[model samples]
Target: MLTISAKEMKDVLYELFKKYEFTESKANLLAEVFTQNTLYGVNSHGINRVPYFIETVKKGIVKVNEEAKKIEAFGNIERWDGNQGPGIINAVTCTNRAIALAKKDGMGLVALRNTNHWMRGGYYGWQAAKENCIAILFTNTQPNMPAWGGKESRIGNNPFVVSIPRKEGHIVLDMALSQFSFGKINNYKLKGEQLPYHGGWDEDHKLSKNPENILKTEQGLPIGYWKGSAFSIVLDMLATLLSAGNSTYKIGLKEHETAISQVYLCIYPEIFHDQDLQHTLINEIINYTHDVTPSEKGERTYYPGERAANAEKHNSKNGMKVNKEIWQKVLSLL
Candidate 1:
């Protein structure tokens, strides 16, 4: 493992992205987003994923310097075409548009089609929270998980995120429908560790904690078994219909996962309710959750985004420990 500073990580990423023909502003934004994800303890989607992102760019699956263009509008709701740009850049653009619309109206919704994989959905949620807006967002991925009671992979383990602004720290819930995302599984595999729990089905169609077996089958376990499968289906339907974009099945036909659909919805709570009351209510809920009886001795309960916030603090002061092999690969991109 290697302990690297956040600034150093960002500087390397910026230089690498610039080599990919990304403009100065875009490179900087991409660098910060990737580095921030790592600092927040989500190495599965952070530095570890940079090399794969560059591969997609090289294969012409992801275009450089392309921005989302508005397709249609309806009052506070709008649809945009991502133009197959960098997922992070397109996601940021759509999120800002949603926030701007929410400020103008009471609520705003942006449906984005033809976008690539947004590395970490929570990044956009935090973006909205920083603007003091409540945000709910989700994105579809390539078909990677099977439906309930099915052997064939036919569903996407789409991610969902929600963020509520707070003075002390934002509350964000970001999760994939699968019990373990592919990235997380891969990370565990790289570390030669087993999952804490059964993460997916092995080739024998049995639940397993071995990441290698699960990845071979590509049959990740749904979060709630049947219930999670249903949630993934509905989210996929909503995203595809709203954005008028490719569905999971359609994306499965592509060589790689690209041109997916996503939705970003933001609400301006202060415009409707008292800010003080909102904060009080939020704090009460968090306190109540924290005060719950511990499931394990000597372990404290945490709210949705609490652990990540703490990780960001500690990692900023100290440094993030990353896999040496992956770190070397990222550096080689230069």
Candidate 2:
């Protein structure tokens, strides 16, 4: 493990991206997002995935130069064709566009089709919240998990995000349908550590913390059990239908996960007369959750997004930790 300042890491990533023909603006934006993800303690989606992202670009699965094009527009909704562009850039653009629309209308929606994987969906949620807008976003992925009661992989562990703006810190919930994402499980396995909670089932169909067995079986348990499975199905359907793009089941037919669909929705509070009431209600809900007795002594319970904010502070002061091997590989790309 090695620790590097966020600025240094961002510069390194920018240099590497430039080597791949990304323009300065695009490179800087990508680098900043990646660095922020690491700074917020999401290594599984940050530096750990940068190497594969580069590989995807090299493989021609992700178009480095392609920009999303607006395909259709409604009163407060729009559809875009990503043209297989880099997912992070496309997602950020769409999220911003949604916020712009919400500024005019009370609500805005954007559906993007034919995009690559958007590492760390929470980034866009944070983007919207920064603008004082509520956001809901979803992305489809390659089928890596089975439907409920089935044995074969048939559903995407599609990630979803929600964010509500607040003065202190935005309340954001970013999670995949699966109880554990493969990237997260692999990270634990690499560290030879057990999961803090039950993540998945083994080949013997028993709950297990052994990431290796879970990976081999590909039988990840869904969060909230059947509820998450149902939610995944609905989210996949909504993304595909709204974007008029391929569903997770269709994407699974291919060896690589590309040409995925995503949706972003933003709502502005200024248009509503009850904005103050809504804000108060949100705070009340958060306070209620925090008031619960923690399972461990001296461990204060936190609302969603609390840990990320704390991580940002600690990482900014102490430098972000990076896996030595991954960092070297990223440098090699430069």
Candidate 3:
């Protein structure tokens, strides 16, 4: 483990992306997106994934210069083709587009097709919340987790995010359908630590907390067992249908994980109610949640995004903690 300042990480990433032929503006955006995600304590999708992203570019899975284009539009809903662009750029564009439409029409839906991984889904949620908009975002990945009661990977973990704006801090829920994401499992393995609970089955077909075993078996457990499996299926269906793009099964046929679907939905609160009243209602709910008794003494309850917000503040003042090897790898790219 090592502490690296945000500026250092961003500078190196910017240089690396520029070397990969991204325009100066695009490189800067990529640097900010990746660095901000790391500062928000999602290193798995931030610095940890940079090497993989670069590899995807090298393999032509992510086309560096391609940009998303509007394909169709009806009412406040629109469909766009990513043109196999960098996922972070495509996702940011769609998020901003949805926010713009929602501001004008109370709500907006942007269905995006052929995008690669969007890194941290929470980034877009926070983006919308910062603009005083509520957002729900969804993206389907390659078939990486097994459906309940079935062996072998059959369903995508399918990241989901919901965010509400608040004066104090945004209320955000960002989660994968799996009991544990592969990134998290890999992190624990890197630290030589076991998962706190059973995360998946081992080759012997029994629940295990061992990260190595879970990674080997590729049998990550669903969040609520059968319920999560069903949720993953429906979210994938919705993304595919809305974007008119590849579903999990179709993505599995590709040489690698690419050309996936995503949906960004945004709602403007001021259009529905008084902004001040909306803030009060949000604060009341969050305060009520915080007022609950802690399950353990000396522990405090927190809302969904509170910890991440705190992390961002703390990491900005103090350097972010990053894996030494991963940081070195990123530096080597420079």
Candidate 4:
């Protein structure tokens, strides 16, 4: 592992993105987004994904200098075509647009079609929450995870994220329908550690904690067996319906995962509830959870986003620890 300050890492990445011909503002934003993810301990969607992003852009799977174009609008709901733009930038733009609409109408929904992979879905959640809005964001990926009771890959993992505002720290839940993402499995494999639970099935049709076996089979377990699978199906339907974008089924046909769909919703809770009432209610609920007795000694309690906020603080102060090989790979780009 290599430890580099957040500023240094982001600056290097910014230079690399600029070298790729991204505009200064876009390059800077994307670099900071990646750096922030690492600082929050979300390495799978952060620096680890950078190499692939470059390759995709180089191959024209992801467009350069393209902007999301608004396609339709009705009341507080709007649809945009990504024009195959950079995912991180497109997601940020959509989230901000949602925030703007929520500021006016008390709520907003934006569905984006033909976008590249957004890298980290939670970034947009945090983006909205930071602006004092409650946000929900999700995206459909390539058909990678298999449906429950099936050995063949027939469903998308479908990352989902939700965030709520709070005085102490925002509450965020970032999850994939699948028990583990392939990027996460590769991370664990690199570390030579077994998954804490059965993440997927092996070719022998047995549940396994071994990342290698799970990767080979591409038979990742859903979060709750059939329930998560059903949830994924519904999410895909909604994404396709709202964005008029390609579904996982269609995306799978091209044997590529570009031109994905995403949805962002933002609510101005303060418009309906006063600040005091909002803070009091959120505090009471969080306090109740924190007051619970730990089942084991030395166990600590945390609310959503609490651990990640702490990680950001610690990493920003000390430095982010990154995979040495990955850092070298990125450095070679310079």
Candidate 5:
């Protein structure tokens, strides 16, 4: 295991990205996003995945300098095409644009089509929440899990994120339809550890914590069995139809996952209600939730994004724990 300070991580990765032909500004943005994810303890989507991301660029799956193009504008809602650009940049651009529209019109809806994987979907949630706006977003991926009863992979996990601003801390929920993300499973597999919960089924069709078995069988369970299966289908529908882009079914036909669809929504609470009233309500809701008795003796309940914020603070102070192998791979990039 190894650890690196956030400043070093960002500076090193920024230069590495520039070596790959990314513009200095774009490289800086990408490096910051990746570093932020690591700082927040989401290594599955952070520095841990940078090697593969760079490989995708080398393979031409992600156009290094491509920028998204606006397709149409309707009131506060707009559509964009990613043009196979870096997903993180496209998503950030759309998120900022959504917030800008909300600032002007009280709300904004942006749909992006033909985009690549956005990496950490929750990044945008935090992005909007920091601006004191409500945000909701989701993206469809290639078919990686089965639809409900059928054994064949028919739908994507479809990550979803929602963020609400609060004086104490932003409330952010980042989740997938599945009980565990493939990235989580891969991390467990790498560490040779068992999942604390039943994550998926084995090749023999029995529930298992062995990540390798789940990966081989591709039997990752949904959040609520059938319910998550159905929810994923609905999210996929919205992303595809709203963005006028590739559906999960069509993405399954591709050689690689690209041209995915995503949606970004932002609402300015000050426009709809007084800031004081919003804070009061937020406090009331949080306090009531906190009053609930703990099911575990040592565990305290935290709002979705609270843990992430806490992790960021801790990692920032102590430096980030990183897999030594992945760290070595990243160094080789330089």
Candidate 6:
């Protein structure tokens, strides 16, 4: 492992993106998001994924210069076509647009179609929450998990995010339907570490923490067994129908995962006029959860976003730790 300062990392990524034909602004935005993902301890979507993103760009799968376009608008709701633009740029634009609409109305909705992988959905959640708005975001991926009863892959690990604003640290929940993302499992494998909890089944159909087997089978367990499976189906349905875009099952048929669907929602507190009450309620919930008796000595409970935020602070100050080989690979690209 090696540590790289955030500025240095961002500069390297920016230069690389620019060299690949991204506009200066777009390159900066992409670099910033990737850097922040690493800082937040989401290397699976950060530096670890950069090489793949560059490869996609080189393959012309992700158009470097394309921009999303508004397809339609109805009051507080709008629809847009990503036109196969880089997912990070499209997602950030849509989230900002949703926030703007929410500022005028009580809430806003933006359904996006034909986008690529957003890479860490929580980035947009935190973006909205930071502006003192509640948000819900959803994205569908290529089929990577099987339906509850079936064997072959037929559903996405579709990730969803929810966030509530707070003066201290906004409460955010960013999770996928799968127990562990393929990126996460691969990261653990690369680090020669076992998953902290059961993540998927082995070839023999037994629960296993070995990521290699999970990757080979491409059959990840959902977070809550059947419940998560059901949620994944519903989320894929909603994104597809609402955006009038391809579902995970449809995307799986393509050569690569692109032109996917997503939705962003934002709610402003001013419309509710109960800011204090909302904060109090959130505090009560968080405190109650932490108040639970530890199942083991020295064990501590954490809310959804707490751990990520802690990781962000530590990594930002100490520098992001990267796999030595991967770092070298990225440098070689430059």
> Judged by TM-score, which candidate is best?
1
lDDT of each: 0.95, 0.90, 0.93, 0.91, 0.91, 0.91
Assess the local accuracy of residue 266 in candidate 2 as a C-alpha lDDT between 0 and 100. Answer: 99
Candidate with best lDDT: 1
Query: Which tens-of-lDDT digit does each residue in 110-172 have in candidate 3?
Result: 999999999999999999999999999999999888898888788999999999988878899
Each prediction's TM-score versus the true structure: 0.99, 0.96, 0.98, 0.97, 0.98, 0.97
Candidate 4 has an lDDT of 0.91
In model 4, the clashing pairs are none
Candidate 5 lDDT over 13-107, as tens digits, reads 99999999999999999999999999999999999889989999988999997998899999999999999899999999999999999999999
Q: How many steric overlaps does candidate 1 have?
A: 0
lDDT of 1 by residue, 259-297 (tens): 999999999998966888888899998988888788788
Clashing pairs in 2: none
lDDT of 4 by residue, 187-229 (tens): 8987889999999889897999999999888778888999999
Model 5 off-target regions past 4 Å?
none
User: After superposing candidate 3, which stretches have Cα over 4 Å from the reference?
Assistant: none
State the TM-score for model 4: 0.97
Can you write out model 2's per-residue Cα lDDT over 1-334, one digit (the tens) per residue? 8999999999999998999999999999999999999999998898888999999999999999998889999889999999999999999999999999999898999999999998999999999999999999999888777778886777878999999899878988889889888889978886788988877778777888888988888777788877888888999999999999999988888889999999999999878888779878888988898888888888888888999999999999999988888889998888
**Could you report the Cα RMSD, in angstroms, for every candidate shown?**
0.8, 1.4, 1.0, 1.1, 1.1, 1.3
lDDT of 6 by residue, 122-241 (tens): 999999999898999999998888788777778889999999888778788988889988889999999999999988878887778999988888888887888998999999999998
TM-score quality measure for candidate 6: 0.97
Which of candidates 1 and 3 is the stronger one according to TM-score? Answer: 1
Pairs with backbone N, CA or C atoms under 3 Å apart (clashes), candidate 1: none
